[model samples]
Target chain A: MVISPSKAAARIRAAAVDAFASAGYGGTTTRDIAARLDMSPAAMYPHYRSKEELLFAISFEGHTEALKVVEGADRPGEEPSVRLQELVSTFASWQAGHHSLARVVQYELTALTPEHYRTVVALRRSTTRVVREVVDAGVQSGDFTIPDAEGVTLALMSLCVDVCRWFPAGNYTNPEDIGKLYGDLALRMVGAA
Target chain B: MVISPSKAAARIRAAAVDAFASAGYGGTTTRDIAARLDMSPAAMYPHYRSKEELLFAISFEGHTEALKVVEGADRPGEEPSVRLQELVSTFASWQAGHHSLARVVQYELTALTPEHYRTVVALRRSTTRVVREVVDAGVQSGDFTIPDAEGVTLALMSLCVDVCRWFPAGNYTNPEDIGKLYGDLALRMVGAA
Candidate 1:
């Protein structure tokens, strides 16, 4: 069967993610992605105007996917600490499983054009907002004691994002172990009551 | 008089550091460093055999320099919490001040050949060992209550390494502030007394 337009776009984005993640963004070319797909570089132009655009597209997709994971893992009526633990642990495992996308999304922001960089940062801001809301809920419910929500958010993100650097394929540090450890640390960081 | 051999090497290394940090290790060329040094690439080959060798030399120098920072920051006789605080704060500042070297050292590891990777990893092992020693001391003295000293050490390193990704010139988060935030959170993570 012929590939659908959306499926084609996904393929292009996937190829770009690998190129940009394996080689730093500055080190890759659009032709590199096309070659990976066995198509002419111009063939990709219909889907993505440039490699930079494709990079941001994949990065945004990764953030959206992560948001869904967080939403899916939410426990409707659990205590705040329990919910926070589940969310952070799930986030770590997701990061480990999807490390290539995470690596490009987290590490290649600097190589984006100023406008594109701002766009990804906005996506980052929205993710920050989600964590903020979760943290705020915990604080309001008398389940936490963090005075600095931004700091706590950064700590949580740092824990999740850094997994890509060390947790590549066939590594000894298993995702389940990392997930549990990060969950405990994030919960303690906020002094969950 | 000709520049002393040591001075010549320092100039060459500084030139290479700037180039590699900007263009990345794989993308950088010896010609680029030589041009930056106002000399021909051939003239600089006496101190290094190849571009990869020069990169290895720079990588080795950076590895040793980082250990010094880790060692010097861990003061004896300080409270466990206080010492850990100082170590992170100083490390954050060290990252900011040496951003070029830090960028090159952290991000370019993938470019190393397997043999080179082993050497660099051994250097990393030493750095991890120092952090482990401090945590062990804290545990022995009843200052910290970590369940696994190794995992906690990995988490701490992850938090600090992510600093180079977000810290910008002049307006980056102050090392002391980061030190304060991470230290407080870290102590809480391990359920410190």
Candidate 2:
């Protein structure tokens, strides 16, 4: 089959993500990524300038997608507790569901170039800001009581983000179960009744 | 000064742990580890057979040390709330305090042989059991009103374990501060009064 450049690029990216997720950013080589996609290293080079660039691509895109998920999970005019649960559930579920991509994006931050690292950090801060603001609002409205909104928000994010570290597919609990459970735990952490 | 064999071994292990933490297991080489200790690669091999063995040594020792920290944190006859606080604060602080070693141990599990991985996992499970039993006791005594002790325990551990991933040294927050805050948050998480 004659594949277009965009299609070829997409295949190379998909293979790279899987390779990096399985073998880790440092463990994966461009040759391994190309091997998975049945392409020569020369063919892969056109789509990605280097392995670091490929990692940046996956890390950047994955984190950006995660930000979108959290931003979309928030609702206007909803009770803060209700909003908080939805946000945690949706965010946790997405992490558990797309764990491979999540692992690379979350754990492989050290491998990104300085510019890419800063950009990814900004996206991460935005996500953290979203959660913290929701939490701060909840505390302000008396829907939640927290000693430190930023710390609690970090713990909440940690709880959700760590799901990708341990929750593999075919585990006893599925992503939905984890989401619901984390949502409940998050509410309790925030002192929401 | 001529270093004794045991002292050389210790230095090699220490250097290996640091290299693996910064460069990752796959990216780090025996030469790098030896370079840090001012030894040739050939001299390094007499102490450690391969890079994987060094990684296994650091990982195994790190996990074993973590188990000791958690196990020691539990004080018999204490209230679950108090016990949980101590457990988390000590555990989290250790992770923060020994973050360079902690990072290699926690993040580089895939590099371990299956047997070594299982051994590390057993230590991890025992640590989890210690926390869960404490949480379960709290719930049974009406001291905590958690929905799922197991899930809550995991979340609690996650909150502590993840501090290593982001909290570098010289940051505004110290290990003790994180520990104190997480301890307070854990109490809040379990609905402790």
Highest lDDT among the candidates is held by which one? 2
Candidate 2 chain B: minimum summed lDDT over ten consecutive residues — where? Answer: B164-173
Q: Candidate 1 A-chain TM?
A: 0.88
Model 1, A1-193: lDDT tens digits are: 9999899999988888877777767678888889999999777889899877887788778878887887787785888888888888888888888887888888766667899788777777766666667787898898989857777777787678778877842233578888888888878888887
Chain B TM-score, model 2, reads 0.94
Clashing pairs in 1: none
| Models, CA RMSD each | 3.0, 1.8
Question: Candidate 1 at B179: error in angstroms?
Answer: 2.0
Off by over 4 Å in 1: A71-78, A168-172, B76-79, B168-172
The global C-alpha lDDT for each of the candidates, from Candidate 1 onward, is 0.78, 0.86
Candidate 1 chain B: worst-modelled 10 consecutive residues by lDDT: B167-176
lDDT of 2 by residue, A1-193 (tens): 8999888877877888788777777778999998997878998887898998988888888889999999999995899999999999999999989888888888888888899999999999999888988998898899998877777887888888988887852242688988998888889889895
Q: How much is the lDDT of residue B100 in candidate 1?
A: 71
Model 1, DockQ value? 0.50
